[model samples]
Target chain A: MATLKVLVTGEDHAQGPEDADVTLVEYGDYECPHCGRAYPIVKQVQKHFGKRLRFVFRNFPLSEMHPHAEAAAEVAEFAGAQGKFWEMHDRLFENQERLGEALFLDLDKELKLSATAMRQALAQKTFEARVRADFTGGVRSGVNGTPTFFINGQRHNGSFDFDALVSAIQQVMITAKSA
Target chain B: MAQSGASKVTPIHSDRILPAGAGAPNFTLHATPDQTLTLSDLLGRPVILAFYPADWSPVCGDQMALYNEILPEFQKFGAELLGVSVDGAWCHAAFAESRHLHFPLLADFEPKGAVAQQYGAYRDADGFCDRALFVIDKKGIIAWSYCSPVAVNPGADGILEALEDLPK
Candidate 1:
């Protein structure tokens, strides 16, 4: 197998699902401004690539740096009950500070969700296992920081420009075709 | 009822400030002397919040020392700096005392990640943090924020340059 310079499995490399023409997995913290910057970019890639791409998200919440991210992840998972995962996900990234019990209720009201049900879900920590799985996946894959990504099985370090992502995907596609 | 509903809207980050251009947010962190220190306390200054995973890590040690090396330069640019981690306040005290760190190493241990949440540098699996840096101007809005790979060292000069290029 031709080794890849961009990634290492246990070192600086981040692991994710294998064998997609394009796989986009992001390691993000809900409270990170840069992660906030990268949010729309990931959405752009997902929207542009559609089903041709497999998108995965892993947690690399720098809780030492972004303390509220872990709590917010739990909150989002709790909100997943009403199928509000994406909504809570965006809300967290957009406004990271309102991540306590009170804010969750307020946000539920704003989103017209069942505050009572959401509170129950959160108290029970229904999404603990799922959040744990995502974090475990991130650690196994070597995601060392926030806002990291794996596109088509290739690890991308640093912030990305739109054109760079397209080119990387194009290269992967070409190699697959030749193989 | 509508007014009550409007009042019900949650303030996004009341204790925290948004990352905006050319301005910084007022932050009152629990510092040494076990009291509060605000961004406004350091008025007419830039602030650098250098976040790291663990105090004992090789790269983090080097990274922390870099701040001292550029202490004069940072002072010249009118910036106050601090290092933060999820370590307890006592741990921060010891780490700073042993390393002879000129700046305070903040304690973000309570709730396991208060400060990290402010900067977005928490990692759940390892229960440690990845190195992240946040630059704030005198006014207390986040000017620039960068999150680096775990083992990497963010160049001191590069960050200083980012500050220098700013409109004075």
Candidate 2:
């Protein structure tokens, strides 16, 4: 029984309603190709479920393998501080192949973020600890790799493809309805 | 938790682990085709013996790759990682190179699960080790152990936590 050691809390970055019927948490790496492939699928699942779903994203960067991952995570956390987490998060996945300093700066401009503040934040390593905390939380939650999902505080031990994810979420919905 | 999707066919993890404070069983196994590594030689530093089923299996590969990526973290606690499998030295060598693994993978092949059996990790029903992990202290005392489901990659957090808990 490999379960999530850490349950989702308010301190976490989350979307949808807190009282949603189903919760979907993803431990993802910004630079992972598999996670990039999963981006659209997760979006589709969100659209399908609508108000029935709550979404949370946590960082679990494999920095050694993905050199750009740590920086990208920090950038997302920075945007999160400015109330623009989802904006940066969506752009990161949308432009997974173009991950770098240049991309972060470009995103800062497009998102109407203060370029000077963003530069100082990166220079001072701000949000590094926050991103690292998210990573540590993921590790404690039994996240072995990127794009690991949890449904209702339990590890979703399945292929994260669109169909599999949909079926798993629907199962939760059915159980909730029956209960 | 919910055992849906990839976990439908996966077996549950049970209390099949070797308990902590027990003396770690020793062995000599081929690390490279021409090189042999003995357990006793690594008694001074904490050792992590990860006995997995075989090379190239999806779960095992993911587990090893994750360990490989986190090798430095294990090293920070002055710990050494060794992957043990029932595969031959040549197979281990190829797998190590293909995955760019930084740790030595000992072959438990000659006697086929001999070392794994001694560690109570061998799964006779499946003819392989049941994806077990053992963290041994400097004095060769087992500090902690876990038996993960064959289909899952039981990441390195437990091992790291065990290392951090080692009496200083």
Candidate 3:
């Protein structure tokens, strides 16, 4: 089994308590259709687990296959720089169907981010390196595709649906508690 | 399900693929509708030949797309990656275009798996190329080769490891 090569650090975008029983790391692309489908399921999982689960997301954009993925990641990173990472992250997936310069600009307005700064950031690719670091980290961690999950540092090979993910996390929670 | 005695005695053909240290087989295959790529022509630089089953089917877990994403990593090793299948040039052209692939996807379609047969990567029963990967050195010698189960996508880690092991 492939284990996570890069551990979660202060640089990571995380939610929930740091002392949570389980940590779920997802290497996801913003424009991947499968990841789009998984978006709500993950939300459901997060809701189901609540304070017991910690979630982290990393960018693993397949730029060739999904043209807007890298830019979307950059946008999220830009939002992250301004402390609105989760809001931008959720909005990107929530509006995955219309991902482009126009959609990004609209998101900037809706999220109340600076239009000028966002435009300059996108034009200059200011957040590209940050997005690329996450991508490269995913690659080294045996991530060949988007929405790859690593539960508690071990790669999750099972389905990403609600029931499957819940059961997998439950099993991990049990093991963690026992240990 | 219980197997019959006849089925138990049936011999499976595990044809040996060209192993490491063997001289790589030279073949010219259609990289596009008009252009042909020969294995020997890329003698000075390392080459990676990936023989997958088909074009449209995600049987190999979108292996071509995975390779397409990591083309830069392969480039860092100064290696050229080529995807081969029995699909026609037109089909490959469409697939490559749709996937935005940077590497050339050679078509072994004219004679139908002729190059794959030479490399022992052809699936005789299925009428398509098996999911196989071959890393050839700068001197046209097989440095490493792997044949994964048809349902599995043998990721690029092995290829990268092999490239790292090659003489610099």
Candidate 4:
């Protein structure tokens, strides 16, 4: 996370549109409780910034401690293929414990994804590579903890609180607008 | 806030920590092949006892990644790095796979916080071990040891330096 500010350029980024005013890229672990706690703050940033900001999720699972983190990313990836990656991402983070491999398949059906296809994807280790790539990029980005953020190409490493996020964004917005 | 340094650290009451120059004590932990590895088993080789605060903390991530990067060096020096935490073996396997990490994340679960307590690294209120590193020489005597606050850490290079300084 400390190195995030220097890592804005990389092959692992998920691009938004050309004219997006603010691009918020996050390096996060699925099972890190701190990441879970940051979920709401990120949501608020999206709310506060609205269409002016583009938010991206980068998976940085701390699988060493939380065995279910990578699978959780896969569930989101599976849902992504069905055009619901964000939906599934939010769902998995909101209820991480309930989304193990068994629970993931169940939720796939709940989210209207093809359970058979989803299972196949998981079996094929489809998004495993993508998750790895993101994690490796996270390493390159100096991401060591959950919910590491880059607000407009600058890293913010501190407590996972929303007020902190809002202030950072507000300061950036004023500076960007003035410039 | 928790007390800093020696006065605040009492492993037996909380995590069971061993002070420097003391015996590393005997304990069994789950290794990479899913086998139980004991401190006594690694007696013949110099051991790098890596204590990370948690599996995914940022500093901890850098610390383990650093060790993985220097695995060959450690092996050349005839050493084994054993990471201990409250996390389970199952989590360790996934952790290794995800990071392409080439080390073992020993499970200090069950007996709850016994090993961490033994090392005086556990913070009972937080339910996690603090960052601590110990280098035990081949004879099973601690040669060098260092501990850090939960958020900050001393780099792995210092331990490697200590290892080189310790009698090989």
Candidate 5:
């Protein structure tokens, strides 16, 4: 089985308790349709598991296919620098179909982040290296497609729909508790 | 009809891909209508040859797109990736344009699967190349090779591992 090459650290954008019973890492592209479909399903899974799950998000943009993916990731990282990573991440996916400079600036205004700084950072590609590092980590971890999940460090090869993900996470939680 | 006793049977070679440590077969193929890329020209850099069945196919599209995304990672190791298929240059050009692929998709269309045949990656039954990957070192020797099931998209983990294992 493929294992996570990069463990979750202070650098990752995480939610819930760090010492939760399960860690769910997702490698996702901002503009991927499949990832867009998975967005709500992941939210449901998180709600179902609540405090038992530690969710981590990593950028795995396929820039070739999705023209705005890298820039969107940079926008999220820009928000992250301002302590609003999850907010920007949610907004990006929520408006995935309208990803562009206009939407990014709008999101900046909505999130109360400085639009000028966001534009300058995007123009200079400030967060490019960080996004690329996440991408490289995903490649090393055997991620061939967007929205690849790792349940407690092991690659999740099954479907990422609500029921499948919940059952898989439950299985992991059981295994961890027993051990 | 009378059957001859003690008739001799001839053995046929299976469609087995070239194994690791074998010298990579060199060839010149069209990367575009005007440009031709020779394997020997890329002697000093590690090369990844991804032979897929065709362009526009679902599995092949995902495989190529995955490679396209991780191209920078390959470049960090000074590795060049070339996708090979029996599609014509025009077909490859259209597909690459639609997908925004940065790497060249070499067209093996002139003799139709000649290079794939040399590497034993040609699927005679299907009249196309099989899903195969070869990591050739800087010295033009295959460091590793794998043939995946046609329906599956073999991820880049094996390719990256082979590149990492190559002598620096």
Candidate 6:
């Protein structure tokens, strides 16, 4: 169906080493229910693999479908500029049901980010371009829906449950080792 | 999966679609109760023909939903995206509204699957169109075609790539 347009690159918001053996990229929407469910599972995936895995997240908000999706993605990208993207990412998914201006303001205090700066960023729409770039990349990459995961450079056509993801990653790990 | 109440008809669209570089067959289909669209009317612009089995089938739902999301990309290439199925105009209207789709879904009803049969995408046994795609260039020639498994979503990557390759 959809193929990854550009592979994991220096511009991505990534966790783990730059040269990790396995690179897992998730094209996600914070306001999407399925992505919220995937949040904890992705955390477990990272914990299980540790140093062997590199995880990257890209914004892919379906703005027309989810009214709050674009705003949530803007907040995440703004937090990324302040060096707390992962924290904001987790908080957004964890507090998915309450995504709005007030929640973002509250998160600014909780995450020790600058409230004035966050407010201005949202008001001025500073990171809209950044979020849109990620979204455009996701669209080109064959991301048909929220929480579409790419293992290596290939699209994973199976389910994203724990066992399915783990086995898929292990298969990649094996392929890498043999090569 | 085949939709419930679909008739058991003989398979006629089992053959592959018209190959790339071939002249695309022409047909007109109803896009809405009051609107009709013809292949010839879309000659100057690129056309993405998305042929799915039925309106409400699960995989077709996902496929169309995804298309609804990236419609701007198709428009960016000066392309017309049309969803084709044997489902009637009323069924398409309901489905498009429920999904908030922004594109025209042509009804290949009346003589069901007539257009799909011209493109070799009709499935006689299933009594619906197969999940297929064809990207036609400005000259009304087939630029790309793909027949995906009936159960899969068949995302827009191939369609986008084909559109990108068309002459400016």
Q: Write the per-residue lDDT of candidate 4 for residues B86-167, one digit (tens) a residue.
A: 8788887877776778878888888866887877777788888777888899999988777765654444555666777877
Question: Cα RMSD (Å) between model 1 and the true structure?
Answer: 18.4
Which residue ranges in model 2 land beyond 4 Å of their true spot?
A114-116, A174-179, B1-21, B32-35, B72-77, B88-100, B123-128, B160-168
As a whole number from 0 to 100, the lDDT of residue B147 in candidate 3 is 77
Q: Which tens-of-lDDT digit does each residue in A1-179 have in candidate 3?
A: 56788999888999989989999999899999889988899899999999999999999888887889999999999999999999999999999999998999899998899989988998999999888888777777777576788899887766788888899899999998999
Docking class of 2: acceptable
What C-alpha lDDT, on a 0 to 100 scale, does residue B85 get in candidate 4? 79
Residue-level lDDT of model 6, residues B1-168, one tens digit each, is 112111332333324777798889999899998899999999899999999999877668867877888888899998999999999999999999988999999999989898898888988777898888999999999999988767656677888889988889
lDDT of 1 at A110: 80
Question: In DockQ, how does model 5 score against the reference complex?
Answer: 0.23
Better of 4 and 5 by DockQ: 5
lDDT of 5: 0.89
| CAPRI quality band, candidate 4 | incorrect
Order the numbered candidates by TM-score, best leading. 6, 3, 5, 2, 4, 1
**TM-score of the A chain in model 5:** 0.99
Candidate 2 global lDDT: 0.86
- lDDT tens string, model 1, A119-173? 6766787766766656545444534345656665555643455666666676777
DockQ for each candidate? Answer: 0.02, 0.40, 0.24, 0.07, 0.23, 0.30
**Candidate 5: clashing pairs of residues:** none
**What lDDT does the true structure give each of the candidates?**
0.62, 0.86, 0.86, 0.71, 0.89, 0.85
Model 1: per-residue Cα lDDT at residue A75: 75
lDDT of 2 by residue, B7-107 (tens): 35456445766789899998999999999999999989999999999998767877887888778778988999999999999999999998888899999
Q: Could you give candidate 5's per-residue lDDT for residues A1-179 as a string of tens digits? A: 57899999999999989999999999999999889988899899999999999999999989888899999999999999999999999999999999999999999999999999999999999999999899988888888687788999998876788887899899999999999
Query: DockQ for model 3?
Result: 0.24
Candidate 3 lDDT over B32-103, as tens digits, reads 999999899999999999999999886443789988888888999999999999999999999988878888
Which residue ranges in model 5 land beyond 4 Å of their true spot? A177-179, B1-15
Better of 4 and 6 by lDDT: 6
TM-scores for every predicted model: 0.47, 0.85, 0.88, 0.55, 0.87, 0.91
Rank order by DockQ, top first? Answer: 2, 6, 3, 5, 4, 1
